[model samples]
Target: MRQNRHITSNVGDGASGAVAAPPARPADQERTNSPGLALGAKAAGLPIAGLAALLSARIVTDELGLAGYALFALITTLPALLPLGDLGAGAALLDAVAADDGSPRARAHTRGTLISGARMLNLAGAAVAATGLVLAGTGTHTWLLGTAATPSAGACVAVAGVLIGCTLPLGLGASALAAIDRYHVALLLQAAGSAAGFGLVVVAAGLDAHAAVYCAGPLAGQCAAGAAALALAARALGMPMLRTVAASVRPGQQGTRIMHLAGPMTVIYTTSALTYGTDRLVLGHTTSAAAVAVYSAGAQLYRPAAALLSSAALPLWGRYVQRRGAGGGTPRGELARLVAWFAGAALVVGGGLVACGPPVADWMLHGEAPVGPGLMAAFGLLILVHAVNHPVGMWLSDAPGLRFQARGAVAMTAVSLALSVPLAIALGPAGPVLASALAFAVCVAVPCHRRAFRHG
Candidate 1:
């Protein structure tokens, strides 16, 4: 996030149009281009798929009675296995392909690496799912969350397994697609799959299929989506279903380099996941289901705003990288600008949420749901705190001191784990939210942000 130019000339030399802004550099402002438009539209499309997810959550809560919490918890936790899935290798593949943009060999190499990566991730995910089942069977499911049902408790482990398995490949594909800038196509496939999956759940609910059959439709739909993504990737790059890593390739060197970069990145991703996911799952277990529902609804509404800030920050990240550690004379001025923009936008969004929260909650939870007002306010506070800290985290990502980011994540996770029980005991659901906000601001926001401008 760096910018400095002859604004006077670009603004028309104090003439009638003097205030007009100059266009940005290609690398820095690629978001202004057609490709950027496609990507933004694709990202925007997430809300639609998210809508389907909300619907699915609602139906599951309303009809099947939250049978999939154990499944969701299990699947989400499995992403912690990110280190083994060639998460770093995928990043390397994308960078290599982009560097060799004109080479056919690069495309083939990337495709092969991606396929290998996907397989690795799928295997790891399967192992996690299996572990979950074993835990459930052995009465050790509480490690997953206190909510996991025992095997004989009649929870649908099989259906959950299938759903978790199907989404794994698609998750890999989505990451691969994002790395390569094929965002629009990925978004469409994700949306279609989510919609189809949710529709199936609705139908199953209507027909009153097997007690746990609700998870079946979503699993099947995700599998189809994964297949479609594979086909699209193959067709776009003229590659095939690669079963193995290429014999001629030197994975030890290439994959290692990829992993080195992705190692911290994977941790970064996983820590962020844990920071929030732990709170949700833990809250679900320790508190009422209705409280979980209310918290989730508030989060769901707040997310789009956070996402938009991230979107705005994306181009600036590239710009910051191009500046090569300088913040364009002001030494991190660009980063600060991006952060300010995000903060301003977040405040507006958060305020709007606070204002309309009751009505919004009522609609989301179905009718005048009679949920807690304090819960809604606490949830909004969580999002706003997240907004402030998130950009600091992003700015930290491009710094040479990025390792600090990983440490921050670990700290945040530690705090989340440490405080989850006590806060739940003391203040119930709101306690976790309070703990999360405090941890992020302390462990992440304050220190890294200071570092961003320290030497500039």
Candidate 2:
């Protein structure tokens, strides 16, 4: 199949002095490229996912108490840090597919190679993660995150490795869908996966299952959903699953190009995982699981808000790529409008949470968890910061600005690591949030935005 091409025409006077008609765009292409429709789909999907997540967290915290909740958080966090074994291939796939200026056969070849590479890498990562977890499980009573190195902990880690392995392909599938202008389908699949995971967690909490059982519910849901999504994407793309997998085994230039993008992205994302993941782990080690629980609960407010901002900006990525490919200038007005809207919405949501979080947390935890005013404030601020900065970050995702953004990520990571430990010791649970907010604003947000505009 040939990629869609837009043709242009110039009007000229004929020998008969007649005007020529301008070329028309294909109807299918027009619909597929509609930014408003794409943005609407993403906006619709994210809230449903966010709501499921919030409900799941509330149910788990209520049923399991702080320590159990902390354990749950740790299980989820560890897998997120593992990079799905592809060294950022998921992101690389998205970038590659979006920026591809090649024949359909070439695109298919690239996708296959990336898919194959990601699977192999995931398998390797899973092995390493399982080994590390098994070692940790056997060596000491308390492993990282203050979880007892019981058989269950090891089992949870193993399950997390599996989840990470599964997530990589699903993410690539979503990217493929987006590449084909199926933004709604991609977002829907993601939302459905998150909802499935949430439902499983809720069921486990209701059954009062073992820690490993509870952890397994979400992991299984994620893996299952990812597989389903990948199947759907393959069918939509008109690609045979086995053939694509087979193609992936052979090395190609497309694969090399993907790795080139993935390399820097891997560094940036690793730093991000550390910045977010290490906070709870540090708290668990220095303080207690209960402290981690309180912090996690407070931090939960940030996710939905951030998701909202992200969903709103997600469609802009394709637009940015399209504009850049066409050698057009950045749409400053559109970006500013989005940033302003996101800031307003964030403030409203953050303010509401600040006012109601303490009461809500008290009710949800049944007084087992404390959501103090200070923690709420910090969490609220974090949400606001993330919301405001989201557009800036999205703008920087363009190829020209990615290097600056990566540098910003590194700086932010360093600052977070430096401040998180001491502040956690001094101020307890509120410390990490404070450190993240400060570091993100000073290091990541500031420099990225500055460079993004300069490049723009």
Write candidate 1's Cα lDDT for 378-441 as tens digits.
6666666666655455445442445677788789889877887788767765677778778887
Model 1 residue 383 CA deviation (Å) reads: 3.0
Give the alpha-carbon lDDT of every model: 0.55, 0.63
Cα error, candidate 1, residue 86 (Å): 7.6
Task: Tell me the tens digit of each residue's lDDT in model 2 across 114-145.
Answer: 55555555555447556655744575424554
Question: Candidate 2 — which residues are off by over 4 angstroms?
Answer: 1-65, 83-86, 101-125, 147-151, 202-208, 241-256
The most accurate candidate by TM-score is: 2
| TM-score to true structure, per model | 0.74, 0.82
Superposed Cα deviation of residue 240, candidate 2 (Å): 3.0
For candidate 2, the 10 contiguous residues with the lowest summed lDDT are: 10-19
Residue pairs of candidate 2 with colliding backbone atoms: none
Pick out the ten consecutive residues of candidate 1 with the lowest summed lDDT. 6-15
